[model samples]
Target chain A: MHVMIIGAVGMLGKKLASVIAKTRQCNGQSVTRLTLVDIAVAETPENPAFPIESLAFDLSHTDTAPLLTKRRPDIIFHLAAIVSGEAENDFEKGYAINLDGTRHLFEAIRRERDRNGNAADYRPRVVFTSSIAVFGGPYPDTISDTFFRTPQTSYGTQKAIGELLLEDYTRRGFMDGVGLRLPTICIRPGLPNKAASGFFSSILREPLVGQPATLPVEDTVRHWHASPRAAVRFLLHAGTMDSSRLGHRRTLNMPGLSATVAEQVEALRTVAGNDAIALIRREPNPDIAAIIAAWPQDFTADRATDLGFRAERSFEDIIAVHIEDELGATSA
Target chain B: MHVMIIGAVGMLGKKLASVIAKTRQCNGQSVTRLTLVDIAVAETPENPAFPIESLAFDLSHTDTAPLLTKRRPDIIFHLAAIVSGEAENDFEKGYAINLDGTRHLFEAIRRERDRNGNAADYRPRVVFTSSIAVFGGPYPDTISDTFFRTPQTSYGTQKAIGELLLEDYTRRGFMDGVGLRLPTICIRPGLPNKAASGFFSSILREPLVGQPATLPVEDTVRHWHASPRAAVRFLLHAGTMDSSRLGHRRTLNMPGLSATVAEQVEALRTVAGNDAIALIRREPNPDIAAIIAAWPQDFTADRATDLGFRAERSFEDIIAVHIEDELGATSA
Candidate 1:
């Protein structure tokens, strides 16, 4: 099977590409070629057995998706997006990348239906990255699968709209799709300060590397879902899942931790010893607090669970996964 | 109270404007003026007691919403949109008017905060006309308020996206808002053709006025909700409801009928005699039947009902509303 990863140079995209390359196959078939897409040309993931190609064009460019579709990969991992903070800062640019860019990608796949001759199985499987920020303000006791999305930021709203489109387009057979609404990726490897949730991981990743990191919100502030390993696994699982059973609602909220900042700090202390916990600074920025409060605290992913997706068993597992990925496996 | 009715010349727009004119006042003050806006000049409602202003400007044009927001209405009823058929027929036009126009309106109201200093008492109320098309596809037993929107058309997709924006913008305190997902309006008092469902009403409405009317779907077909009177009342009620109880999700599924086409025909026969029913033609359009079947058969509008929004009790009342509105209350 041929594989493509849009935003292949980014964090999860890089991790996922590496994982797929290492495995070399899914269910015993070889990954013949890998098409890596990003604005800054990505370093092609070296698969000892498979061939590779890379492109550095902006996905929003009218011809990008169609050009990619011409290659006709069996699977497409679409992780490309304008981050929340940047999206909030530049309105038109945000909509251009997150909303219009996505539509362009899907339209490209749909146009392939009769390229040769009309066939039932012409479209490739599409895996889209969504986020938990899709659910916002006035959240219930436990965010259920049935909760209607009331996104607070322009970013969240855009993601929610994308989910709707992915579902409808997939239902119409434009593409076989699975949209995973990721939680904030805990202990995100390398650097903090860009994303609003950068501090969450920055506190952990920086400390493990012997550096101090700021905590913008109070320790009691809670938010939702998963580790980077879990996100990659979720994408892979969604790629191979029995989509016929899921029916029309193609997108889903991936499961994750419901712990507050204090709990996260506690978990870090347990996993890396007291020295790591000492590196976090409690600064309490009200702007960040206001933004965080608008996001849903947790979700009961009943549907995704029923569909056979899984997540880390505990914070120790989350930390262990991060340590193995960022540090050497021996460090954990 | 100052009121503005955008899209005042369209079918529903004219009905709503006429209703608002008769409302007299809101919260104890006399309605001082009524502003009507549309892409073309609007029908001036007979409101001799109040001042009236009509503006002919394309909302899809640059800075349209900002221009309208300058009027500073106490309550603004935004009914401007290309209908589903037209939206599906022309993709670019659909997004331009439905998505971009809606955003422009919200952005304009958001700007009002900076210029006016956002007093607690000063924010205008924005009411959006959403549609049942927001809920589509082969449905469940009944579409409850909690059911997720899985719209099929470009129109439905746009409306669903519009609902998300309305919620987010309203939550941020840009302005108070309410979105009403109205059912397919029956007995639409107009010409005899077009709109897949136009035949549902035309089969009776046209025959009453002595014309041949076609039935595109079987008489056994069933779907959901309201008379124009109830729908107009819904807009008014939504504008005045206690939204504090609604939390961040402000959109409501306004109430209506769940009757079958046979039931509709029976209602018509009872009200207009056998001659009206005799003019019906049994010509089915598959494109329309497919679209109509995908629509929800019934909706459990528990939320809207609990919130105090009501609809006509029966199809008989619906027929009465059409005659009264079109032929006058004294015609009987």
Candidate 2:
């Protein structure tokens, strides 16, 4: 089957492409072609593999829909979005890319299918990567998959709106859509991010690099999380799932460990020893405190789990994912 | 306290204005001034009890925010909306009025407060009239206030987005916002509407005027609703309640009666008797049937009751409201 990744260059995007490119079998099965797409120029990987097409073009322009319709891959991995902090900072740009760009994709595919009339059985499965940020303040118990999404940030608000549109369009028979509400990715690769949750991964990634990391939040602060590897797995699984089983509730909250900052410190000590823990600095930021307070500390992802969606079982496993996948190390 | 009603010319808007204007008290307390806002040209009612201002200018225009800040009323009944049926037909206009216009009001209030700092002391309670359209597709036993809002229509989508912004802005202390998810307004005044659910009101309303009316669905199809009087009471209650008591989670499922179309028909007979029933035409429009099929049948509005919000005791009261309010008859 032909697979396409809209944002095939970002952290999870790259991981997804690499995983699908190699693992010729999943629970024992054969793989085929992979198509990668993004606004920026993407490079074709080396070695013999399925035919590759790299496109460096803006998807927000009005006509991008026609182009995507032309590409018509069987499975679509839509992982691109305006990050939270940046989206909040640049409101117009964020809405343009996140809201407008997403609509363009759905509309394009919708037009194609409308013309095709479902006779050829040619509808592609589109997996949308959503976030826990979709849920907001005054949470009751653990936020169930059915919790009303009252996003606090502009980014969260945009994503929640996106989820609504996806469901509406899908209900109208536009495409086979599945939105996965991913937990905050822990032990993220690359430089420390300006994201409020970046410190979660930074404390691990930075110390592993023999550098000091600042812990902005307190030890008792708990949050939802999964690893980049797990995120990729979720995308793959969503791509392969049967749409009939999903019914109308196309969005699912993926699993994650609900651990506090203190727990993360403990896991870090176990991973890189107490010396690395000693390298961590304490600091306080009230702006972040307000944002963190609105977030759900955990979720009861009964729906996603029942659907076979999975995530890291422990913070240590999350830390290890970074070491093996990103830190140039084989299985320990 | 000073109160303002936007979109005062619409059916419910005008009814709410009249109720509040004639009131000796709102939420059992005296109200001082009432401002009625709309884009259409309107004249100040000669018999307006308290201070009343009727303005005729587009609230969706660029300059509305500053103009509103200058007026700066203490309590705002933000009943302004593009309306469901109209919004669904015109996408761009729906977004501009329903979404951008709301943002403009909030931003205007924010800027006004920013200029005066805490000394502004000008924060007003805002009551947003949301709709049951916020809940779509997934039919369950009873929709809790905790149920996720997965709107099916573009209009519902806009309202859901508005509720999110209202919650976040209220939480930020820029405003105190309360959103009431009203069920379908039954016994609506004037000519029949193209709205999918318009048949609910048309069946009774048109027949009362000695005209034939159409019934769209089976009597067994149930939905939630409050009488016009109950809806106005909800607005007044929301405006006067102590919002600090609410803390966060400002949006609420306004109390309503869960009645079937058959019960409504029975209520019509109870009021107008056999003559009113004979004027009803038995016909179902497929387009409306498609839309109504996905609508929620009932909601467990336990939260609203606890908050002191009220709805009609029965469908009998709803039909009686139409007689007492619209037909100018105290006794049917």
Candidate 3:
């Protein structure tokens, strides 16, 4: 089957492409063609078993979505979005890319599906990478799958809107859509982006690699997380999962380990020894702290667990995965 | 202060205009001008106390929003939308009017607010009419203020998206926005439109007027409602309320009477006698029944009540209001 990944130049997207190329199959069907897209130019992974097409395309532009749709990939992974801080700072750009871009892609697919009056025949499996940011606080300790999405930021609002459109479009039979609400990726494998949640990874990622990193919030501040490897697995599983299982609500909260900053530090100490933990510096930025305060701490993602999507059981396991994936044997 | 009503010719919009004109003030401010616009030609209210301008315009059109923004009405009542059943059947038109049309208005407001670098001064009070359809079922008997919105229909999706935009736009200080999640308007004073919930009104409306009406579902099916008068009052209240108290979430579930179809019939019988009750014929429509089954039945509208938005407490009260307002002494 042909598979397409938009935002395929990003860390998780690259990991997902490499994993699929290595595995050669999804849900027991061989992936015969891979189309990778991003605003940044994507380089084709070496020694892939399938035919590959890499393209740099801005989804917000009018022509790109239709061009992608013309390929008619059987499976589509849509992961492109502006980060939370960027979205908050540049309001118009945020809505233009995150909201309008997603809508354009969905519309393109929908128009293609309706072209022949055989919508059912042409419907593709769409796995949308949503975020836990979709849920804002005044929240319970563990936000359940059914909790209200009153997103506090423009990014969250955009994601929530995308989820709604995905559900609606799926209901209309234009696509088989599954929105996986991913947790903040801890020990992310690259340089930090402008996301408010970046500190969650940086405080762990930098310190463990013998470099000092700043902690913006107090130790009591809790958050949900999955490793980059786990996030890729989530995308793959969502692409393969039974759409019938989702019913009316297309989005499911992916499972993650909930840990306070103290817990994360302890996990880091366990995995990388006391020297690694000592590399962490305490610095408080109230702007970032205030943004983090309104974020959801934990989630009871029982729905995703029930559907067989897995994540690291503890922050130690999350750190171990990151070390193996990014640092390998050279780590402390 | 000038006020604009985008759906000025619709039942709610027309009633709202006449009510405001009769009072000649909104939230204690004298109304100097009224702009009434609709896709159909909007006739200026007879002997309007304020200087009233009526125009035929489609909100979905590209240029209409910019034109409307040029006037910069101090209070904008955006009550325009394609109803649910129509939205479900005609997908493109639903999105064009409900989603894109709403976005255009919001963008226009945002642009005009930013035009002079004095967004705070240009910020207008925008009262948006949302609906209970925003909440799809798997609901609690009394859905609280913070319940998730998982709308099953296209119309509900559109409204949910609108609410998100309203909140974000308000947050950014472009507009002072309030979204009122109105109940199904019981005994709507008009010929039935294509809405699936139309029977909620028709069953009561036709019976009270000594005309036959069909009940499409079982008598045990429960629903939430407010009278047309109460709905108008809710709109006006939303327009005038202390927006500072709204916090970050701009929308509130307006209080309404929750009653079973059996209870509604009982109320109808109390108001118009057994002969009137005899006018309702049971006609089961599986499609509509399925749709209604997925709808929210009740809500704990504590937030709205505390905010001073009120509705009828009993189905009989709703019927009485309909009689006094629509039927009067001429009804059988």
Among all candidates shown, the one with the greatest lDDT:
3
Q: Candidate 3 clashing pairs?
A: none
Per-residue lDDT for B317 in model 2?
Answer: 88
Q: Give the root-mean-square deviation of each candidate in angstroms.
A: 4.6, 4.9, 1.8
Q: Tens digits of per-residue lDDT for model 1 on A51-161?
A: 778888787788878888888889899999999888777766777788878888888888776577775656788999998877665778688876767677778888998
What's the TM-score of each model vs. the native? 0.82, 0.80, 0.97
Cα displacement (angstroms), candidate 1, residue A84, comes to 3.0
Q: Candidate 2, residues A1-332: lDDT per residue as tens digits?
A: 77788887788887777777777433234557777888886666788377767776566787876686667777778887889888878766776778778878887777777565763455678889888888777787577877878777777877887787677667666678999999988888999878887888898889887998988877888898999888888888888777778776788999988899998889888878989998899888887776777778998999889989888887889988888888888534
- The residue-level lDDT of candidate 2 at A39 comes to 83
- Number of backbone-clashing residue pairs for each candidate, in the order shown: 3, 0, 0
Task: Give the DockQ-based CAPRI class for model 2.
Answer: acceptable
- lDDT of candidate 2? 0.80
Clashing pairs in 1: B225-B256, B225-B257, B226-B256
Enumerate residue pairs that collide in model 2.
Answer: none
Local error of candidate 3 at residue A174 (angstroms): 0.3
